[model samples]
Target: MRVFVLDAKKRSLDPCHPARARQLLKSGRAVTYRYYPFTIILKDRLVENSVTHPHRVKIDPGAKVTGLALVRDDISKVVWAAELEHRGEIIHQRMLERASLRRSRRSRKTRYRKPRFDNRRKPEGWLPPSLESRVANIITWVKRLVRWCPVSAISLELVKFDTQKLQNPEISGVEYQQGTLFGYEIREYLLKKWSRRCAYCGREDVPLEVEHIIPKSRGGTDRVSNLTLACHECNQRKGNMTAAEFGYPHIQAQAEQPLKDAAAVNSTRWAIFEQLKRFNLPVEVGTGGITKYNRVRLGLPKTHWIDAACVGESTPKELFVKCSSVLVIKATGHGRRQRCRTDRYGFPAAHAPRRKKYMGFQTGDLVRAVVPKGKCVGVHVGRIAIRCRPSFKLNGFDVHPKYLKILQRSDGYEYEIHSVSSPGLKAGAPDAI
Candidate 1:
């Protein structure tokens, strides 16, 4: 990926190639500004003296993972891309645990208290805490990218799948019955629901056709609940027989199950779309149909970052991916606010430190340590966990604070760059990243 650059006045400049950034640093013309996204500040250049092109940040938001891409519209080149993993499920589980503890404590009857009535009213547009966190994460990154790069526009995949239409297409009349988008929505929903494999044989990476659980000749409807993806061989073998006749009775039951991930994406889609409009950029919204159309037309493989690059009507016909690796960012929130840690029985197991920092070192800060004469004698580099004493934990080893040098402060996110050769890349397509 290219390195983000800023001028001496702290104004956004065009990102430079990694080799150009190296030359700037070697000749004392620039200095490192941030380490996570790898940004630099020039000592002698100003934004007025340098020309910067406008870039658009495209987002493909999912339930558990979101894809982000910074594209130069003039050249149709993708400069930087990242995948952000959400913690909504984790947050929901924690909330449930807290509620259970509160109920248990109330049953003990240690003190007499009046029961409160259900008079609390939620404000308009209020989402649950779990869903709100997903919106906050996307908004936080959009603001950060705007500050670091010259972003003039934003494109977002507003709707992944229409659950209501998929359930009953006749509700919307003729348009829903015979629309190009309805087919795309159903195909995408089925792919996600069946894990993108053949329902009967579990074959992957091959062309999948939508097959009926009960053949139409057997009085089966075309609703989503009756649809299942199958490979050509399995579809042909099934013939006019139902799934049960094909010795896969379980397939029918699984086909009727609704996809939880698709529901989550639908719930938060409009919330994120409304939040992006507050940025005052040219916000462009696209349906899932166009996104898939562009990706297939370009012959790109199926990946979150690649989907982000093909988001809207503004997507170019020829895309030039300029990087070999994509940055994977996971949302690891800041430390908990609770001062007391409790065990399974709801008793206090241990008390947290009153101060989070010790000896100028805090937990979650990336650092490098060179222990001179301890059991851990070699060099170590990772995020540190600070204690009240001088010792700190680095990659599961103890080291003193004197030997540590802070590289980057914690920003509530963990970063990792995965090359195209990594196992996460699907379809075995040639590396365009």
Candidate 2:
């Protein structure tokens, strides 16, 4: 519904309606800038003041993927939507691979000192590589979104499940419950006691619902320790049957404690909130239930981008979505910090790229390329690999330099691509996987 505008020198001024952009283009007062989130640069100065509006960025963060949406307050239409795929698992695997390779080197005749891990200590705000990447990815985009558009405020979904309620949904000890946790209704005691898993199914981090270990239909009382968290499917399947009757007798022998994932999320959530607060913007946090409610109520599929649009306090009643397009981004951190590339046999083959930028563009820069009529026709938008001569790689496809146009530059992280469901807007498409 709205298009972003830049001054003659490409400095962000304010956003205007599509009609104004059209008029400016027709009168030769402006030229098109970016197409994904359409923006234009003015060639003429305007006597009228900048028409600025409060824009909001919402986030729905997950372990694997994160959803983001930018909406103009006046129109409530989505200016941009993205599904950011993370490389946390890849990073973890790479770390493990390095450790294994180092062990093999130690076994061979490679000269080395004793393991020096004892001398190294974790820095402050240290998180496991994967979780740390997740937090940093969210923070990175929060800043990027601000660069392209004037984001007045940010909203995020903080926690998936209330720990206290997960343990004891209804406790009569109001005084005791209200003492610690600063009035947080989540009773993490039960979650911690159960090792954060389903007593019956032993699964975790799947939007767990509170389940009674004993069937209430069979005279079971509402005891805090008797409750457990289970996935929706398991909860419904158990269907009021006691754990014993539900064929989970082995649960008694299994260890009871919060699952690793549950503990990580519980431990890192407040830290993420605190980091966002340092951005100096009015950041709003919401619960997972609130995001789900808004998505279901809006009759939208449960995609990450949709969940992001439904993030916090000022949930839009309607979306001004002109196109159902997604800007899929993958975090490809600032190249690699390592110096050399090695083979699986532990022999050094070559060194990594010494510089981030080549030619005029960086590896993660977004570009549009038009090939000749022989093989690939029409313009294709994707991340580019700046290479030699007239040829370059556009998202793994070979292309020439003359046909490429730079859309956005890499900011030391992430690569963006454009994907659409159908021609002129696809209907009845599946939710983003």
Candidate 3:
């Protein structure tokens, strides 16, 4: 892990090794600052003309999870890695809920107003809230990392313009006759994916409609990956219920679509590229094919951050920390956007916290509570929700402050350091190990 540092005046400096930071802390020369990014504050004066390492930031943007890695110029190792899980789906679901609530309220005993439409025109390069959230999240992390590390160059994966060749090796030239498959061809594809049988009920040679694996009522999209052919009886039986709810255990095997994922990447690829160009650093772009090729060439396992480590011009050949702890920085935007928090009946659900900070801990502050003797005896690490003194709710568990150690201060959003141990590593190894 890269250790961020600050001079005596608190001005940001280039990050150093974790061992150096630990040595500084042990020798009373520096003190720990942030825990998530693992920063340190120096008590000594800033040494003029200190050597700096050339750090490169690699980002593999995805629809749900974005992979980010900071590596030295040589790409021999990843100093820091993160998997940023976006809240795009949650935002879209909340938008649907808001619309439902608004319609319900409007249909009630309320004044009828003419619906406003066409009054506002979408600006150029308009994207849905879900897509916009992902773009903004990538931009947020890029700007934030520049402050902590000496990142001079950026590598971003833009898979929107990839040559989408058919996966079937037999199909080519004349097989590509009428552009792409359709009608009976799509039916055959669905049959091939589902083993030519019903998804929920095993049957053969029956009339089937192009059924949505997840019903439309549940906000499932019209993406072909969500489409499957099911017999008329099975389709009717599976109305509005998920495949799992309809007694299909392994029915979603066909949901993985690189094309659909690439389409999602296309929606915001240029937007993110343009935004990154606005920065002063040099930006380099690559395709998803090269990303996959690099990962396979290096024999790296499939993980968001692992893919990120092998992204772009500097193809990483190896990782020093095989099973490094991943910093999952979920996008929990500043606060609620609604005017007032309300319940389903339109009544005030609850009051917001009066103060941002309670005692010393705030809602998003990362704290570790080690209760020596209680029901919560084990060491629990999570963000603190300080409503009551001495005791506060952590992600969900309740703990007291006496045993709580503040790891990182609240920064509006929540972060988690998942200590994923490498294979064959001893259990006694430290989290950083």
lDDT of each: 0.85, 0.71, 0.75
Per candidate, the number of residue pairs that clash is: 1, 9, 0
Report the candidate with higher lDDT, 2 versus 3: 3
Worst 10 residues of 3 by lDDT: 424-433
Q: What is the lDDT of residue 256 in candidate 3?
A: 36
| Tens-place lDDT digits, model 2, residues 140-192 | 87876676567789898897555555444564487445743443344475577
- The TM-scores of all predictions, comma-separated, are 0.77, 0.65, 0.74
Report the C-alpha lDDT of model 1 over 104-134, residue by residue, as the tens digit. Answer: 6678763323457889998987888888889
Which regions of candidate 3 fall more than 4 Å away from where they truly are?
11-14, 45-47, 110-115, 161-213, 223-239, 242-260, 316-323, 339-361, 368-381, 388-391, 395-407, 420-433
How do the candidates rank by TM-score, highest first? 1, 3, 2
- With a 3 Å backbone cut-off (N, CA, C), the pairs that clash in candidate 1 are 323-433
Clashes of 3: 0
User: Which parts of model 1 have CA positions greater than 4 angstroms off?
Assistant: 110-116, 164-258, 422-433
Locate the minimum summed-lDDT window of 10 residues in model 2: 424-433
